[model samples]
Target chain A: MQAEPEGFDRVLSSMCTEPHPVAREAAERFLATNPGDPGTYPTVAELEDRAITMLGDIAGLDDPSGYVASGGTEANIQAVRIARERARTDGIESPTVVVPESGHFSFRKAADLLDVELILAPTDETHRVELDAVRERVDDATALVVGVAGSTEYGRVDPLGELGEIAHEAGALLHVDAAWGGFVLPFTDHEWTFAQAPVDTMTIDPHKMGQAAIPAGGLLVRDEALLDELAVDTPYLETTSQATLTGTRSGAGVASAVAAMDELWPGGYAAQYDRSQANADWLATRLADLGYDVVDPTLPLVAADVPTPTFEALRDEGWRISRTGTGELRVVCMPHVSRSMLESFVEDLAAVSGRTPTAVPTDD
Target chain B: MQAEPEGFDRVLSSMCTEPHPVAREAAERFLATNPGDPGTYPTVAELEDRAITMLGDIAGLDDPSGYVASGGTEANIQAVRIARERARTDGIESPTVVVPESGHFSFRKAADLLDVELILAPTDETHRVELDAVRERVDDATALVVGVAGSTEYGRVDPLGELGEIAHEAGALLHVDAAWGGFVLPFTDHEWTFAQAPVDTMTIDPHKMGQAAIPAGGLLVRDEALLDELAVDTPYLETTSQATLTGTRSGAGVASAVAAMDELWPGGYAAQYDRSQANADWLATRLADLGYDVVDPTLPLVAADVPTPTFEALRDEGWRISRTGTGELRVVCMPHVSRSMLESFVEDLAAVSGRTPTAVPTDD
Candidate 1:
């Protein structure tokens, strides 16, 4: 097949919002120069193998057999679907899905889509899943229990090791929704690890921490046999070896993911993680010293407990802070964030919180 | 936000398999040169208006309103979901969906996912939905009746005019799945016009004939109220103004789709339709003259009835023909299909079909 346009044209594609440049360049290069034998329209099975192998390496899992999906939501939906299907196979009619309150909203959405009953397990004081609360919710009717790695709010890792023990004891499949933290956790907070957990399935999105591109999500299964329940074989596009909700996927995305995986593994991840964490720590210290309450003092992500009117004051100081619901501010110190930018942001935060300057009319 | 990379790097990104070059370039150019603005993220309402305006111009629906989806399957699923929701609104508890066997399998998958009972409406001798059978299947419990425009099998369109009457008389919603043929039919043979039919909803994929890249599927409804039933609002993502299965979409795809519509609309489709028809006709004639059975002799897509042995023999001749079931051959004269290539394929077909060449001696 003719190669898709690269560079500016590649970025403009409506197929995906913002594909990673390096990944896209790799795809274009592959197109310009055939990587393997020409004439074959690479089989879905081969792509699946490459993705599984690459994602497995990233997640610290061995042979993570799974399917590719459009995004985290789709992956979560499919994982839930499989969880329900597996329940049915094990002779349960109506299955309940136990999820933490702080878990990804995708679990609830997936439950809604699957028509399964949702049981929200209470979170601990730290805004992470409480192991005992989750244990109390599991029953013979429970299909799956979802655990969070790094939650969107508070940015604290859940006690998966404790939760996994509870889920396994109850005979329910434990699904780790690591969509946000899956790509970064391996390299962050050395104490945070999944070496002891019996995680049946997990979701990983490269679009977030891996920072490969948009529209990259994976549902990884520890054992291969679990896929048989969700396996769909179609004449046109079979899921015999593919991981997707839809057929006829853009090979360009797949190629980019592979390249992104190559760039992110090992040394690159450790360095990037440390940088983001350092930036987060620096911001937290500065914000706290300015008399603002920094939520989750230990976590890399910090939220400023500020009055609603404070947003205007901050805006005047040229600070681009995000609102974390009512009376709070949220700031993300991603890998791309530099120390100078953090210092500037901190300075602006202080100026905004310290005194009111000359009024600048708000756009609204 | 910084414009994502394009070219070889982009293609390797996880966002998409292929990004439209021109559209990608245009979007990147716009982003690079323009200042940041909130208008960059179009609201759901704005998207609905744009879709309605575009569909009204192309499909000739006076009050066309639509919601975007990632792919054709999602559009079909949403359409089915809405149809069922509408049925419930009309006081039908258990809604039944009647679909032709030739329709895309997404309907069946959606039916399974939505928990709606599926009734396979028997088709006529031509594999089109039999109107009488569909009429018989409709009852007070019937939710929707589906019709396919340009089925993947033979590129044959169902008689939507007749089916529309049956659905209307039975008080069931009529949905036309025009995902494949919507962009082509307006410019193809007007004799098989289903454009004037009473379709409550229709799906069209820009990535196909519109050539806007991938993952651009839309569900256009004559009555916008139907979409309201599927509308969901979340605090994180603003999906209020438009309805979609997703929250954070690749805005890049939307831009490209808009660009593609502008580029391929009006007289552009005329050329594509003409070329495809000519190629189909030419190939069909050549296949029949060479003593091969072709499905839907009058259609643009030819499915050659060749034995497996014959197919494998022809495959050795460098023809990458797709096979359905045991021995059915499907040939599509897509937009990029060149005339000389088709002629060359025909010549090679004649040589391959003349006689099964003896197997050459090999070391194996």
Candidate 2:
């Protein structure tokens, strides 16, 4: 474990964005703090309140109901739990949820754990959910209509405003899975939050684009009062009276996420995304010149159709990357994936593609 | 966030055990490692396997299938989910889970989240679940029978061997939640694991009596092949094809638990617990001499029949403690609860109880 982390150095891991060094310091700062048991440690509770309020402001809610979950998986599962509890209170039976085929895998896990029927809404060529297709799936039994803010495959945000309108029209609650886009799109012109749509719940991860320490995923809901309905009381634990999905959790993640937000929010994060965007644009252009059909990136993530041989070669060269089931290579331009690392990756990619990659202009 | 932790200065927190400083070092070692997306991290995955195997051995498991959950809440929910999945596959509908009244609150949470009917089996005078009451609760619809090895209210082991036999006779799975008891019971002559009972699933927390860093609870099962039935595929993640409830998690908890185990496994932990037991016996005898009826401790946990005035007085003196709903003052004698601290606490209790405590003989 003390081998100096050769695993993550300059690795273009499509599944993750590199966590910043600030996240580590914050995690260490609260290594002894367990925020989950607020009764025992009140200081962590204050930090949790501050973190929630700050995230709520960005998500367009003055006061919000939420929990700092382990990750998107727990957040997504909790969102469904909230929706199901809401539906049950309204006398709905056998409630169902509709999610896009491009949605994160947690929806399926939630569907399985919650005993709810999950129907897939179709996606178009860009991998965005077809708004009309989703509308057709929302019947009287639909408790939630989920729209993916950024698909894991292509980082394409669905038409959340249209989806929200359709869900409201059908009397179904809308939840946005913005696990990847939440941190970045808040800085961009992308309309992906409560300001642009009437979202009942949303999944946001500080571990992803916010570059916070691990396990800092959040589930933010509209109203603060509805939380009483979500709690399952465990008389023994100081944490059981709350609506958290876990019992005793570290304040390390919450502290790190709040610390990252303090550093990144308002204006500092925009510059980080700008650098990632520049890297993605340069990489996409270079790959396109080599005859790869790359989906134009919306964030730092880019997906390109690559030959299986070339995809395998990238792995052999110690460049951490991922591929779709169809062998399309994906690159997440994290801060670690620098210009020099990209140049080295393309050199090996070119050898397998049987073509040379033309260099792109870098003015900045 | 850096408020100099007045919350945990040798305070005997009933809900927590102090994490060793070595645990903090372990967390720092992998602060940058996020093994949730395992494809990017080949090293952490291997370490996770090693840690799981080592924990499984201590739990008397030859080979186990499990996840390093956030804590007991997630692990208990997952165990119930696994039972429900197995029951549904066997054509049982509306699965029912029977738990002892002394069971942890996570069972009630799992019942709510997973849509299972949770039936509370009655406990006896000592707060141990009656074997007959538990036996009568199981039926054809039963998916799981939960037995707490050591109840948080009263640290008493239920007859797990008998409970397991009944569950097996009913063709139901038994999940033992040994979150607090797993670490210490192994050193004691307590029959709490696979060696004593046929448990399908078990919950253990390294952060609890194990004294690792925060959020290191695990759920271990008897068989390895059952994991395939539990996983939801995330095509983009390195761990996409595996079974995990959370998507993005820090590797800090895993590294710390492994490090803690390295420090405390076969013989090292025995010496630590012996000191705690000696401290508990001396304190309990001292309290009983003050005319306070104290429950004999089993695993460094003691419950005393303290008046409201004394309980409030102790709290006013800045000691962190918890009380049973019935007003029994509880003290979990963790490694941090030194002999001097217990001596001082008993002195305060004697003052509040209007009696003088007699000195106890201390012998190795």
Every model's DockQ? 0.21, 0.60
> lDDT tens string, model 1, A66-159?
8656567777777788788888888998989998887666666676567799899887777778887887899999888888877666676778
What CAPRI grade goes to candidate 2? medium
Candidate 2 residue lDDT tens string, A1-364: 4534445555786445555777678878787777777767777778888788878877787777787888888889888888788778878898889999988878998898888999999899878888878877888788888988877777888888888888888777889988877877876777788878888898888877778788788889887655665787757444447788887877888888888888788676788778888898888998898778898988888888887677776788787888764567889887667788888787778775677554432211
lDDT values of the candidates? 0.62, 0.79
Please, what is the TM-score per model? 0.85, 0.95
> Which tens-of-lDDT digit does each residue in B32-142 have in candidate 2?
676676677766666677678878988999876677778888889888988888889989998899999888888888899899999999999878888888878899999
Model 1: how far is B317 from its true place, Å?
Answer: 4.8
TM-score of candidate 2 to 2 decimals:
0.95
**What DockQ was computed for model 1?**
0.21
Best by DockQ: 2
